[model samples]
Target: MILVTGATGNIGRSLVGRLAGAGAEVRALTRSAGRATVPAGVGVVEGDLDDPGSLRPALTGVEAIFLLRTGDTDTSQILKTAAEAGIARVVTVSSLLAQTHPDSSVGRTLLRGEQVVRDSGLEWTILRPWEFFSNLLFWAPAIRSDGVVRAPRPGLPSPAIDPRDIASVAASALLEDGHGGKTYPLTGPATLTPQEKIAAISAALGRPLRFEEDPSLATEDPADDLAAAVSFPGVCAVASPGALSTVEDVTGVPATAFRQWAIEHADSFR
Candidate 1:
């Protein structure tokens, strides 16, 4: 059986469905089982990653795990518990920033989690994905209200990955062998500037949209902060040189393009 932490999140939600769709015994761990909605035939167990002791019930019968780092969670202890529970494999979702911008706060946190998993003695695969296309959802409100996206860097480009692609890679690593001890850096098929992304959304929504470069835009919301962080100029460049092939190489499917993702999720901007 495979246990998925952060089961309700963007990547974890897709990961659970992908595993179950493949006929794997899947269990989803959530802080509140009452609130989590998972695929049929999947088990839901209430647990808190922040408190490692709360994970025991969820860990029962789990042979492999998809570990997603949550805020300040004690990863070392979690891995210790998983090892003690006899879970033999772990697939973790980290960020490319851990490799590209190691000095950054987010990079440091993710690197620490990766180290813990490596030290756990379990068969492990780490996924370091670039900015998620879902981060564009941060502009939903502004787009809905005025069809305008205002951000600091309009020309900066990112090969922003789809979270589903990240989940697909994780599923392969968890369910297949030959992936242990490997770290995969993942990205979308093409790099796109904010203007280009807005154009894609506009075409998807069948309407025009605007991109405004506002250097003074303040990021108060966590979502906005994340979107802004990924827009940083050098973060994507460092990771994108050869990382774009990882999704296709690992999953036998090409990495998703931002325009396609934008089309699929156009309702959010509408």
Candidate 2:
């Protein structure tokens, strides 16, 4: 049996379905499975990462686990519980910032989680992915009301990846072989600026929209949350030489483009 934490989240939601569709015996571990909607023929277990004791029921009979990092997660304890439960493999969804800026606190937290997973004495695969394209959902209200997207960082093009691709790669690592001890950094096919993404949404919606950059809204506070998320300095994997694959090189599937993702999720903006 395979266990998945954060099963109700964006990537976990997709990962659960993908694993079930691939005919794997899957168990989804969520704190509130009463409200979670998982695929058929899959087991739903109520568990919380905050409480390691809650994970025992879900870890039982599970050979592999896919973990999603959360603010309240105790990485070492969680890995220890899984290892003691006889779970042999782990696939952790990490951040690109973990690699780009390993010295930052947020970076250190993520790096420490990766280190714990690697040292757990189990076969492990680390998936470091850039920001998720789904984060653009934050612009849904503005686009729906006035067909406009407001943001800062106009010149910084971010490689926003589809959450489904990350799940797909994770499934590959869990169900297939040779991915142990490997760390794959995933990204979207194209690096797009905020304005370019706005244009793509406009075209996908068959209407006109505009991007409004608000430099005044930009904060230089070192403790700012955005600074921890996407404020990495001197790191541009998209512009770097021989950038890593969109995760397709290893998963044998193409990464979804932002425009295509927009088209599929166009109704959200409406």
Tens digits of lDDT, candidate 2, 1-270: 999998988899999999999999999998887999998998999988999888998899999999997886888899999999999999998887788767778779888888988888999999988878888888888889998676544545677788999999999999999999999988888777777888888988999999876657555573454462454321122331123575789788788888999999999998
lDDT of 1 by residue, 56-98 (tens): 8889888999999877888889999998899999999887878
Q: Locate the minimum summed-lDDT window of 10 residues in model 2.
A: 233-242
Question: Per-prediction TM-score, please?
Answer: 0.91, 0.92
Candidate 2 clashes: the total is 0
Task: At residue 223, give the lDDT of candidate 2.
Answer: 49
Candidate lDDT (C-alpha), each: 0.84, 0.82
